[model samples]
Target chain A: MSAFDWLPELLERFKADYVLIHEDAAVTTVGRARVLELDAEDWGRAAGVAAKFNLRWAGGWADQLTDQLGGDKLQINACLLHQGDVLLLRTRVPVTTPVLPSHTLHYPGADRMERHTQDMYGVVFSDHPDPRRWARHHAWGENEYPLRAEFPRMGTRGDMPARTDDNYRFLQAQGAGLYEIPVGPVHAGIIEPGHFRFTAVGEQVLNLEQRLGYVHKGIEKIAVGRDAVGAARLAGRVSGDSTVAFTWAACMAMEQAAGVEVPLRANYLRAIMAERERVANHLGDIGAICNDVGFAFAFYQFSRLREDWQRLSREVFGHRLLMDCVVPGGVARDIDAAAVAQLRAAFAPMKREMRELMPILYDNPSLEDRLITTGFLSESLARLLGATGYVGKASNCDLDARRDLAYSPYDRFKIKVHVFQDGDVLARMRVRADEILISLDLIDELLAGLPNGDVRAEWPMPAAGSEGLGIVEGWRGETLVYVRFAEDGKIARLFARDPSWFTWPALEQLIHGNIVPDFPVCNKSVNGSYSGHDL
Target chain B: MLRLFNKIRKIGVVTEPVMPGRDPAFEEIGEQLHARVGELFSGSLAIREVDAGSCNGCELEVHALNNPYYGIERFGVHFVASPRHADMLLVTGPVSKHMEAALKRTYDATPDPKLVLAMGDCGADGGEFGCSYASCGGVSKVIPVDGVVRGCPPTPLELMKAILALIEKRQGG
Candidate 1:
């Protein structure tokens, strides 16, 4: 029997109805996720069952449905994971008075996600722990829900509003000698904006409450009514660094709904692009983490490597950050023999430089001393937060989507998923470093094994009311893109779950008891995406 | 440590001598930038970056200026931590509703005669995430923009060129 056979039976015991989501098993590639529709009460109870069965809280989102789509209902979907299996529990509440039981008591990471869903869809969780405005921050009217089908993509207002939202209540620490440190929506570095409220006792942090949504450009709201290709382009911008992953996931969702078999060679190109994206990001991050710790030497070196890598990306893929490369049916750019040769040549030096740099990092006492025990997230805490990618891998979560979910191109090779039990800054760095090497190897394999055929597979758009889910392991972690196609191939709904959503909360948890100064290195270790999370 | 030094020595002088520009006009702008900085802001130009709302593609390219290859610091262009210390603002993204106040405050905080060069297509006119309830269309909608460097996210060279061109336009005019 499959590993998740017990999951359905356990949920059934709780009296929740289930619908097999991936009916087109014959055309399944991105359809491996098990999606179930349950009664609102049972969906909440499923969280308790998930806790009991040790299923990880993957993510949750709320969608606004129009009356034409059966009835005006607020659909809530929560994803739970056990091993490699993805179980998405869904339920609908009347839009007039949408309410559901909260999962925050069981899953601590569901706190912000639920608030985000509520902010966008105007749904309420009965026992939500912290219900302050998240993405709702003064943009729309108090009662206005932007995600509602009735709300215009461009709001009723003609002009941007003024900001008076200085008072986002952050839980403060009691007792003497506890002070609050307010960081930014506009950070010091060239990074995306997000405010961090740190409650500290002298040098050590008591807690970190993040106030993001500063970068919310109404991406999800604007996504509605766009064709699959247009929405996929917008999806690429959901997180710039993980553009390949986001676009690939969006395309996979559309392709799955359309039942189009993507050319085998296209998958290889996608994998190569994805692996390059990972390596490029890891290279930049390695340097940034070092830079934050008063280590400028590695910073310049890694930045140089990343620039060179991105230059090659521009030469090969037409965008430095590789934006708009992965399209709806297949890829936008195709690699020639010469470009392939250029890619191989470009990768050799960077790979060698990385290998040489790792030994020095390991040998350096100052770095080791700082990174070894700092910002620790226990394996249990990581699973509790549903952390994925290097964050999860560093904490010994040990699951990689490429290996666990087993997609095309990756399915051709045995993926090397790195796991470290340290759960510290060094372990996180180790994960990035090791993953770079693994990605380089994967790219090499992709180049060697690439099939000779057409890159783009043209197909008719699926009929209206079609929906699919796309999940990919990005540079940061798991990226989920869900798409529902409307009439004339327009998007009825689109949700791109940045890896940062799950891991951002983990940063808040991990920073506890860490010195205020150590927060930078610790933060850099996680390096959760603000743009991705805000969108 | 010794190995690091050896590696450093081997990779010595990686910075390009001249920052390459896209065209003759940009090249001319680049050639005149250092001297223009001398005339306007003494010898150094400090830029404070405000990310109103972005996918972070512009930030990546902007941060590349600090890289050994770009070596923007060599031209006495520093990215300051605060707007008070900045002579110019290299802003990215369309103005998101939440960040409008932050961007305005950043612009106000900078001393007068400060240049504001909007970077990327989003910064120019809210490229994809257009004028909506959330986005304010462009940087100019919130604060006065001296000039704009437009691309989905302009390359480092293009961004650099735009900055130089912006300086020349303001001071030369």
Candidate 2:
């Protein structure tokens, strides 16, 4: 065996309570750890005890122990990462009982992460203080945790509970004459359903609270029992707009867990698809953000260009939005040489038009007036809230999983992350607009050095008790997925962390001194995905 | 004003025929949108997006389309903050009862010339969210339906195709 085979011996030497359910000699390393090993599911509690005893793991490897496990090994999953000595424990259990100890005490990242796990899986974090319903507040009822193994397929077969009086107390506004303007759960446009409660004193918003999850689809629970192929299909639908990102992250996680190697060509194609998704969404968001402020011309121009981009995706990649093109182990489809050349041809015109249009948008007085200082968030607030995607960058949070966390081909290419310090609606819009240009440039680079090899790789059957973790930069922000498998490689638990988890709560926080009317413009600036969070 | 002119020039110009709808005013608005926003979004439109107890797939696409990619403006079409501002209601999901009142309010708020466009599989039928008592079936059950764009959540382009078709149908062309 390779040098990593010492992992089993080291676990015993460390006196860690690991049951070594299975171990494979395969290696998967990207500057951290590269060993696929399974242990008794209660390994987290033991690890907690180990941490308490100050049993320092080599290279911060002690934190990866999973305390609780759910879902069948055939579907339930767990993964351990040990690089020179740091241990990271990850599990993918179905939403049933989804009880896991608060890993925040062990790893600070798990703070938002545990909340995310609870949001999608209905997993109860032992003592998560901010336990207010994450993605389920406005969409599904209390009993609907999406990642449970037993969650009925064929679309929630059980009788839904009666609508009871929502006992949630509105955080009382202290000032006199503070009236609440409830905007949605239903709104004026063809927009998603979310409730916005504005505590306004005349035109000034004293506070604004958002209640979302009107569109909870139980995607995680549905993903249980599905094979790697089936899981990617579900992953693509996590949030339809960023299909490629979601599917790629899930595939990356699954491939790592199973110790399967993806072809170089597949990796490049995935990057191309991801860049395309990034461009498409940025184009649309820039236009929509402008439209929110009554900039009809910006809306018209951006949307027209967006429509053209989507048409091109359909022609080159098959599905209009390139849905289901990314599969596990490899992509479901490949871009031919002609398609690559067409994409190259298409970008130049699109880029020229965008260059001309941006100045107009920047120079427009009325649009600037509406966007300038609206919905400002300080740098500290953004970091505390863990904002991802463009919103995070606008607030000066220099983190992009594609760059900082660096996965696969993304690690190979130097990703240009756009950052801003303004942290306002205008900054958010500008960041998104500029990101679109960068994405177009990236696509051109990927096409020029396109990998020449097979695009699909046969994924090996994961040994019983294997697990993995996936994090991808979705259009809205960072989407995290944790997969755990039972002894039979069945999906035991699947937690898909939507960027909306942090962004949604931040929406309420951002609306604080702004007027009620500016809420739509501000909300559109972030555009968090409720479905991605809900599942 | 120069910015406006330049933006217009960048969009290029489209000269397509407008279609007539049940109402002349909507038809007229559609014609104006055709001249201004181009034919892709020119017409009286109603939108019915089902929530099909969704994970909110269709909603993001719908939101993105409205935001920048396919900003449903420049054509005189706007995502009326209320159904009253709308001529067509676009529905997205599997139609959950929780969304029923809001959907009805949105649809009823629209005056006439309102065409209902079922956005995703959830709206056309129940999609994956169908068959639950929590779900209210399709958009037609709640309001009059004019067109359907099917997929788990039809891509933004597919949605554009349906909206364009509605514009043509409104012109009776």
lDDT of each: 0.85, 0.65
TM-score of each: 0.96, 0.76
Encode model 1's per-residue lDDT on B11-49: one tens digit a residue: 886676544342354345455777777887788999999
Candidate 2 lDDT over A1-535, as tens digits, reads 2434655565564355443424363444422344334433543554454344433221111111233433232222222222223234333333333454454454333344455455545566665555666444433546754443344453353434324225555566766787888766665555566677788899988887666555555555555667787777777767777788788878877887798788988888888888888887788778778888888777767766766777788788887677789887788888888999999998899889878888888888898899988999877777655576788889997767677556777777888888999999999988887888888888888899888998898877876556666777777777666665655566655566667766776677777889878887898898877566544
Across residues A167-199, which tens digit of lDDT does each residue of candidate 1 receive? Answer: 677786688888898898878888899899998
Q: Go through the candidates in order and give each one's DockQ.
A: 0.79, 0.29
Docking class of 2: acceptable
For candidate 1, the C-alpha RMSD (Å) to the true structure equals 2.8
List the candidate 1 regions with Cα displacement exceeding 4 Å. Answer: A1-4, A15-30, B18-31
Best by TM-score: 1
**Which lDDT tens digits does candidate 2 get at residues B67-129?**
443345545555555565556777776666556656666667678757788878778887654
Give me the displacement of residue A444 in model 1, in angstroms.
0.4
